[model samples]
Target: MTTLFISDLHLSPNTQDITACFVQFMRNEAIHADALYVLGDLFEFWIGDEDRSEFALLIKNEFKTLVASGVPCFFTQGNRDFLVGQRFAKYTGVQLLGDETVIDIYGRKAVVLHGDTLCTQDTQYLEFRAKVHQPWLQWVFNKIPMFIKKKIVAKVQSGIRDEKEMKSLDIMDVTPSEVIRVMEAHQVDLMIHGHTHRPDVHTFEINNHPMTRIVLGDWYQQGSVLVVNDSNYDLQTRPFFNQSI
Candidate 1:
């Protein structure tokens, strides 16, 4: 069996390029895969069910297409798109996954996550995360009007950018110790995730053997995807139609 993983698309109403690419990906690449896992941030931001934008609906339809094709797909909450819930999942025919989920990918036990919780340094953001992800918060957010939600998204994005600018890159990224801790907790060597938008393979020693952390890149400058088959896993970065080097 083959499995595909992608995340951090940051999809929203205005990001036509990313939307186009994602639609193409689902129609072309995802159709044949045995399974698909969306780590998180598939949308730029999700306000709630009461105010889901047309873009979200479109993407949800795209996902439903994939699901109707008989391939299993799962979605985990990303920081931006954390508002995704049971309603959205049912509409898209996707199985909603928790923060950290362990599954067997082609024979190897792999741990998958959205990866933000591993960023142990951002204490303030962690607190916000806890609050926003609660069931009640989601219910309230969905009750707000679309215009109000858009304004909130703008405000939050501005604050998030400012916060990222103040924090060092190392601080925003996942900590090595945290990764090891999660690995130990999950009892898995191969972990795949996305959050920081840094695409690279991190190799470390575990039990006197080499372990790997595969980070999935966000779909902004280019398209990044990880494909795993029965034999091995491959990370491929593809340039968008008009993207330049």
Candidate 2:
């Protein structure tokens, strides 16, 4: 059986190509996998619960179909779309996974993340994360009306754009020290995540043993997927349908 992992689709009303690609991926490539792990950024913005969007309905249909077809789906929140919760999970037939969580992947211990925290250099974003992640704050925010939340989110997105404009690429990317720290803290050499949109499989030494960090690509010019079956793992990238990366 094979398990698949992907993230940073950043799906939105305007991202029709990515959405169409995703729909096909679920219908064909991902439908038969043993499990599908979406590590987050599934939407460019998810302002409210899953039940609110027809887009969610489109996504739910595919995921529910997958569950019915026997492939379980799992999710983790990213900086942009961490508000996904039980309501979305139930509607989509997927389980919401916690940040910095570990699981047995084909009998190997694998630690998964959305990868925003690894960008330790983005101090402002980190601070924002701290505030938004407070349980009390999240509860209060989730209770707000969708229209109000959308207004707030539009502001947040504008702020994010400004940050990207001002920050250097290195500042917005993962810090090597933080990656090592997380791997060591979790005691897992295999760390897989997506967020920075820089995809690669890097090997490094940790405690005198080989360690791997797999960065999943954001779906922009192309889509990437890592397939793991038993003791085998393969990272593949291709031009999206008729486009190039």
Instruction: Report the C-alpha lDDT of model 1 over 1-245, residue by residue, as the tens digit.
Output: 57999999887777777777787788889999999999999988877644556666788889889999999999999998888888888888999998999999877887899999999988878998999878887778777777888898899999998988899888888988899999989989899999998998888898896788999999997788998899888888756674211
The CA-based lDDT of model 2 is what? 0.86
TM-score against truth, every candidate: 0.94, 0.93
Error of 2 at 112 (Å): 0.8
How high is the CA lDDT of each candidate model?
Answer: 0.86, 0.86
Model 1 scores a C-alpha lDDT of 0.86
Candidate 2 residues 1-245, lDDT tens each? 79999999998877777888888788888888889999989989877673457776787678888887888999999988888888878877898898889989978999999999999999998999999989899899988888888889999999989879998999988999999999999999899999999888999997798999999998987777888999878887645564221
